[model samples]
Target: MKNNDMLKNILVWVVVATILMTVFNHFSTQGQSATSRLDYSDFIDQVHQGQVSQVIIEGQTIRGVYGSGQSFTTYNPGDPGLMGDLLDNRVKITAKPPEQQSVLMQIFISWFPMLLLIGVWIFFMRSMGGGVGGKGGPMSFGKSKARMMTEDQNKVTLDDVAGADEAKQEVGEIVDFLKDPTKYQNLGGSIPRGVLMVGPPGTGKTLLAKAIAGEAKVPFFTISGSDFVEMFVGVGASRVRDMFEQAKAHAPCIIFIDEIDAVGRSRGSGMGGGNDEREQTLNQMLVEMDGFEGNEGIIVIAATNRADVLDPALLRPGRFDRQVTVGLPDIRGREQILKVHMRKVPLAEDVRPSYIARGTPGFSGADLANLVNEAALFAARENDKLVTQKHFEKAKDKILMGVERKSMVMKESERRMTAYHEAGHAIVGYLVPEHDPVYKVSIMPRGRALGVTMYLPEEDSYSYSKRKLESQLSSLYGGRLAEEIIYGEDAVTTGASNDIERATAIARNMVTKWGLSDNLGPLLYEEEDRGGFMGSSRNANVSGEVSKKIDEEIRNLIDRNYERARQILVDNHDKLEIMTECLMKYETIDKYQVDRIMAGEEPGAPKDWIEPDDSIPPAPEVKSSLEEASEKPKEDLIEKDMSNDEVKEPGEPKLH
Candidate 1:
């Protein structure tokens, strides 16, 4: 972090120096042009007339010395003054005194002091930041100037990381090797000096390393890979040395470099702005990992999500010997993460881990924690004793859709359009076998959404098929179609502006990225839309004609899907009306209610809609050995026996 600050400071100085030099050069040039406006002139006549401030006489020629006070000979022009004007002013010249001070002497004398000052200024500027004058003379550019994070400041421990069981277990072995090198040597194994943690952002990669340090009871040095780069050539190499050396001094230590992709990126790829500085930093890092220094006790752990872009040398067998992958949690893992976070909050019986875990299919550890916090906040707002499952439902919706605005208002026409729009989505969601079940649908305002149809995916889906993508596009158009079907040409607007954008992009991507279009063929022409908010246009690659064709195809796709959803809603008009009526009355309802309307069954029909009485918190299924169940009789389930404090009734908050 200090290195980042120093680089910023250095940049500031360079900018300041450049600006000052430009301004100073501009004014100095202007002054010189004004002073030297005329060549050594016949201006002596003016000086002889006493109008000129000062004058110099040389070899019968004269020049004006422009300044305060008369700085010239008082003698007449034809007086043939004694050279130095007779150091004694009273003396008159007797046929031009031999060797009178020349014009050269006078000019040199006047500007010499200024010349000296300029030279000194130039020297000092070079010292401040190297340019042309300081190649190897005490000045250089672009140094690795970020401050190094010492051991004491790395406060993260393994205990702080709630999920990523497999990742933590892999990192644990590195710590074990560092703590006792002999144990590994005895097993005929050479301890790996570096371990690379690869995962999406907020996956606790850096936090894992901090825990290793904490567990080993050793120093932890932290710095970003960018901190090793600078405008200077060798400075990055120097910083690399410094970082590893510091780690070595605190041997049996862990050095965590966050966002290693910044420096460790592939060389010569020339993507996203390029230079040799990053290359040098990465090279130095490579050597430092496997150099003659033998960093046996100093383990280097770096984190980056784009492991694909990293240099091959950095990930070789001996360098970053271990690569740990951090993935999203499974259903049971999600439950465990939710429980861990719930422990910090006041939870009621209604707040079931299994329910939330089932709902949060794609959630990471961090996402689950945020869900719990958001749920707690919701319960607090309602003055409830403890957070209920419904509060989590709201929190989950908020987490997915965004916060609810109690102050939201709607016009009658707009409200009706939204009701049908949401109904359209609900109806189509249940009709489409591939799509997740609709949990709730509401025209109530929340975040950027005018209305939302909450769907809980049945399981984690790592990849999607063309069928799935097409289904998603159809699902997206449900709202707009519902609006258009009721209002005809004049659908009351409730800001489906963003929704339109989402649906449009999905159709476009199905044609472009997913190769789902029969016309375009099955090839991912455009990159997958992993993330980015301004729609899926960030990595678009196609000509205007191609883009036009894409747009046409997307429109055709949505048009067909819209009709598909409209037909479903029309066929299920009774169910749609009932769903809309429930929404109109209650404003919001859960999955069970939605199921009743769709299945045309009574509220308590199958009894499977009810929360099960025997359900308990399930064991988290992670691949790590440490995550396995104990052989001794497994501990009693946590959720089976609920104290009064654990369960909250409808309108009461249990005091802590």
Candidate 2:
């Protein structure tokens, strides 16, 4: 087919070139001989004098050669005696009729440019595979954009996928059906028409689909849902039809649509009702899946993070028979995923996948792969032969807490204040009974924060308890309270804006959403907008009195926690100073040092710390306080916003 197209292109260029050459030769002046033009009287004088040896005439125009072998041309006057004079003078007259051109040739010459333009247009269109009404062209915009892969082309199998064992099992049956449909047919069973894999992004839903194709050894067709919809109204519907037709041709093939939510949103639920093109596309998809024309042996698998917003008809048993939830991996699943990715990297003896997985509780499969890649990069940057635990630790820190901003200079007083602020958060979290353990604290600037206090959960918890929530509330305000106690009321800065906001939100959720408040009496007051076109309706039903009570409860919760955090800081002022001084000296401290500080002892150096290699070039040393004080600061101080104080939900790590 490609050879034929190339041949056609070559033939077109030849034809165009031939036409251009013909036109050039027809009107070119290069063919004319060197001839001098003569006036009519001079031609007559020359003829009378016998200077023109020979003459040729066509109507009023004449051409002749003189005795001197010179050529000349002139327009003759309408004189009846000219022919006689030429004859009497022995001018050797040669007469011929006037030249005439055919009507067809004249017309062709006149319209040649337009014709050439049209030919070029057609050639370009054909070259782009977009000729008028041709397949896979602009005129045929309804054609499917799905990429097809034969059985042997896809290399990924189920073994390559990890972190979703249940999802894998659910899809294993699809593979079996594709491999041999008769097994289920003999048992009086029919395979599902469609399967929907719902999960957050990067959970390997698309990878699982490819694995199914590999395991079944069948053709695979993959496309994004957005590819179907276009500005034209019926284009999306047409594409859906064309896609299903393709799948039917390759029977027992799998069709995977990724990010289906783009076209599968619930009908009439968008901002101003719904998108016509998207709705039409969704409607066509529905009809193709479970319509009157049965698509036997063609399994449609779709993936989406926002499954809640999908239309109800699309989720019916006849259409999508199963919904596989490929959520974030737990510890065991994470370890498996890490091991799968780590197989490519050269790891040292201290590299433990399980330990890394435990530390990264809520990471997706893609995130784990990225973590492995980042660790390898760190090892390579240090000219190391193998990726070690230290490299992994640096990569993990970069991912969880933003990269360290060592170039950002800070004032001495501001540094002291940041140390106290982070110390306050650590001390309160340590004292709080139900809070997660404080993992690390730093006075050095990282990300947007001037300082950071990290907390690592002992284990993954699916839900948060009331005591834990209260402890979290206290810890959140710990930064602000510490600032106020140390600097006095008027001297406290706005660095605790994020802490105040987060603490308020936690207290509100406790009163309204969680119903932890005794005054709320286990009632749900908060109205959530759960994938709805119109905003939440529950809030409209609550009375003014109830709303006022909810606000009062939220305020009381915040006030109680605020006082609790303040009192803790006040009692442990000595411990706070010790922790702050350690932070000032080392710029960073781990959990053990924090424990020592809390025990009223001087914190020691980190035990597992690895010093920089002497062979590697070191960064320029930072100037001392005396040198910095003499010169103006090179950079402005970053705002002391506690926005990086990540107080996550139950499943996420609670890094403060």
Q: 477-592 in candidate 1: lDDT tens per residue?
A: 67766655544434235456766788877787788777788876876557745344633444466678876777788788888877787787667767766776666655666778
RMSD of each: 19.1, 9.0
Would you list the C-alpha lDDT of every candidate in the order shown? 0.69, 0.86
- Candidate 2: TM-score? 0.78
| lDDT (C-alpha) at residue 447 in model 1 | 81
RMSD of 2: 9.0
Flag clash pairs in model 2.
none
* TM-score computed on alpha carbons, candidate 1: 0.64
TM-score of each: 0.64, 0.78
